[model samples]
Target chain A: MNDVRSINCTQCGAPLELHGGHRTRSLNCAYCGAVMDSHEGYKVVEQFHDTLRPHCPLHIGMQGVLKDVEFTIIGLIQYQTEEGDTWIDLQLYSPTHGYHWLSDEQGHFIFSRRVRDIPKPAHISNFKLKAPVFLGKQRFYLYEQYRAKVQYVEGELTWIAKQGNWLNITEATAPPVCLSYENSVSEEDYYKGHDAHTEKEYYYGEYFFPNDIYQRFSVEKSAQDKPEGIHMAQPYQPGLTAAMGQVGGYFFWVGLLALFVILFMNADEQPRLKYHFNQTELSTPTLIPFKVEDPQKLLEFRISVDRLTNHWVAYEMVVQKEEENVLIVEKEIEFYEGRDSDGYWSEGSREARALFKLPAAGEYSLSVLFDGGSQSTPPPLFVELYEGVVVVRYFLLLMALSLLFYMWKWFHRRSHENRRWEPVTEDEDD
Target chain B: MSTSPYPAYNCAACGGPLTLKFRYTKIITCPHCGAGLFLEDKAVKMRGLESVMADYPSLFSLYENYAYKTQKLTPIGQVRFEYAHGFWDEWWTLMSSGEACWMSVDEGDIAIEQLVTLDKMPFMPDLQVDVEIELLGESLRVTERGSAQCIALKGEIPEVIMIGDNFDYVHLSGAKGRLVTLEVQNGNLFAYEGQWIDPFEVKRL
Candidate 1:
């Protein structure tokens, strides 16, 4: 740039360069500890005996892209408060967009710049913490206020600066956006009762993740630098986890309805196999032959006994598939406990039947035996069987399992939002 | 035959014959080749890209002159300073008394300030913006404070400030057209007091 001046230190004759900015009147020479005047032909204005200083991540003239804008870091200010707190503001510049400030406090960075068009608050006294204010129709809440001091300076600057300049700062935050008010009471003309007080209020904000600054600038210590704390503006993606539950909810119900449909598709009613044996004094049990059909269908048998009094009867049934003897489905059909009290109660039944899901449809023979008391009046025995198939229990179980899975997701997201808003302490709906 | 306050001279950079209409302006740009000169220092420099124009968004041309109240002021050279948001010009105007003042046009807020020489003032280094302080027996609040880089200089100024020089200034505005500017120049304090005016109050000639 034609505006830049290249010269040399008057004393040491070391080559010096003044940044093209028309406002940079003086600068500290890096080669020697001399503060030289840029306008005064590079004359040394002040000399320092010590050359020791702290290290900084950025040097003058470093260029980096932030948030899609390219800027050159032209200056760095190291500020320390009386309470031992320190922060740094890196002055970034673009030929097209002018100057911006990147403030690095501890490990947190706030990128900002001077701006106009900021809406004035209705009243200045209303600027308090948690107070809601509107800027350009966008609402924001006041977050914090403090005072800061500048302890050191380096590189080019647009305005004259001092090593110990201090400012009172107030910030309003709306997440990813913030408003800052910097007030400086100039020591100039103060004693003359002409206290020059200045206030600079502006808004600058953008949310940055932990690795956002590092990756965005391809920083050297980016891998080691970890951003800590929950920024108000950090993006919340609860749907990333909750979305799975929502989809699962839809699929779960659909699967349950499908299972019910499938269970009923194969549902059938089969004829019952019944055989009877009547005898006063039971000797060897007689075998009753019966033909069976489908074996996959659920088999049920219902047996009934007639004319039984105080005596209880027990019976055993065995199914033989032709030459192959199947299972001996033994059951007791006793009618000993009679109904006599206020509520009719029976411990054992007189007739009983057992269901065997036969493996194959073969010629099966059922052997039945009945036993009764010798002294008591025995009942004339008769047996009957009925069969039915239904899947009501299975459908109910499927519905319960699907509902439980989806409920877990909804509850998880609720806890996530609760933890996120815990700091606010109060909210409306969301 | 002329009531003009100053003598005429030739433009230094362009060697164009020049005439002065008011004695207060320190720098004057050549009409022929557009070369601006620092009249008090007699240093003539050409306009760069940064100092492209004297007025922006507003269409006041280089020929515009103004009559502020009973004072006859002529718009001379201008100094351009920029912030992150935008840039404005400090229009240096010479009065009939051969004195210079700065007129600022910001967002239609027009103000003209004359330099103030205060005998005693508070230390400005620690003063913060938005803080209220008593000045001239009136309570005032510091409204804006920052450093501004002088991007370009086209007019004559009373102070010995160079282009690219840094200025730490605090701005304070009060009710009823009251304003104060505190600037740190050469490690010394400088103040300015001014009043706001309407756009039509400054008659164009």
Candidate 2:
């Protein structure tokens, strides 16, 4: 910390402590509203009476570490737009990094520093809404343009700022980072023309959360203001729900991979039993014997009939182990196709499958009996039984739930971005 | 009689004892009468009385040794220049390696630079803010262009210091904190190239 310098106001004789270094051009006396020229020896350059001191959480000489650099709050200026929207900008000075600004609009804070590099098409008049503005290699979109008048000032500033001094500000943002162009317009310039150029400055700003600001400056919770709306430069903060969604996204891919692996592993297996029968053979109950080697694995019975358009077939089967019925299954296979106004349409399938577990590894006989059909005589059908099949319906269900979870977070982030870029009207600002 | 290791001389105006700390010192102020003196062919000549600067917080003091990063520097002389807005101080420093450099202090901003020869000189009247100029094969943009008058002087300076001498200066900046300062005095041009130094990195020795 540097030593504090004090001087008596030339107008009201009130002692004012200077917190800034030699670059400070003006010091506004809080006691008498006298703007003193710091460069030319504390002379009263301008005076404004009855100017109310604006409320600010941080005071002059308050030092804090921002972005690993120690800075002291040297000055504060409050600005109000014609529509009554107000914000406060604090001038921060560091011995090494020089001067910067901390802007407080409502509860949001943005840290900005003057940049020497000029942006292409330096003036705001050449800018369009949402058009890309290039500063060096980085690109930004125009965010807002407004004219604000200085309402109050205290401590010291790099430039002389009198009350009612108007400034035209143009802001462009690329999320969490923004570029600002400020043109100071005095009353004389305004009377001359709106395009009269005065002092032009460019600043690059980064958004800071309210909590981060409070914690950085060690301000009390009571002094903190509640954030009302989304700040233009505020980056999307993924909350706990969004984190969960990201985790779900990972799981969704894992579930799909697991389903693929199961299908790949089951691809080379040969059926344990294969049976062919005609419609005449199924007129009565026919027995087909098959031996099950592994009772722990699941058994799949697949039945398919020859192509029979606009026809259907149904059958019932009983699995018996040593004359004792272990499982009874019923299935139907139907194929129907026709042309519609939109396109060719098809319904049903020619194949049906059933899954079951055998009680023991033993010889089992399947008794097949024709139940019903579209015709008096059913078509010939083929039956195949396989073991060690895996169910993929559970994996599909898991994937569906995971995708929904992730989409929830994605939509939330999208909405936040939408609100951040939403245009503000005069009524909305009020 | 003097115990100083460097060459010692008598002030031209006051006949006070003076010592040249650096090999390239061209001008110095007499301690007794504050008269600015210049050295020509082993003879000291009087220039004029230098104005004293108002006291303020500064990072460097005349004839004070300081450590900046890995290099040790001693500020032998200081020249204060008053511009339209404010004034800045340029300290002619003697480094441990026997090299002389200039440390410019404007507000809290500081830079250490040494004189460098450029292949092409920029036209003084054509220079403006945001204009790009090539210096030592590097493209630099003019960040500031202004004229300043010397307000005060102290200690030994490598360049001739005349009180109230005005010079137009242009500050050009490039990538990675590179700084190039171009000063036009009378009709001659001087250029210095260096990087901006952080004041916090300097420690008094």
Among the numbered candidates, top lDDT falls to 2
lDDT of 1 by residue, A1-430 (tens): 2134566666677775544343355566556656656556656666644434545555566566775556666666676654667767777655434456776655556777654444457334444556776766788776655556655665555554554456666667776677776655433433343422444546455555535665555567733345444444444444644666676688688977887776676465335555556663233556666765767765666666776545555655666776567866555555555567576765666656555587876567666655445334334445444333444566567666656757877797566545544544442223
Query: In model 1, which runs have C-alpha deviations exceeding 4 angstroms?
Result: A1-56, A122-127, A187-196, A222-224, A231-430, B1-205
The global C-alpha lDDT for each of the candidates, from Candidate 1 onward, is 0.61, 0.84
Candidate 2 chain B — worst ten consecutive residues by lDDT sum? Answer: B48-57
Calculate each model's fnat, 2 decimals: 0.00, 0.28
**What ranges in model 2 sit over 4 Å off?**
A2-10, A13-15, A253-270, A276-299, A303-382, A424-430, B1-205
Best DockQ among the predictions, by candidate number: 2
Which candidate number has the best TM-score?
Answer: 2
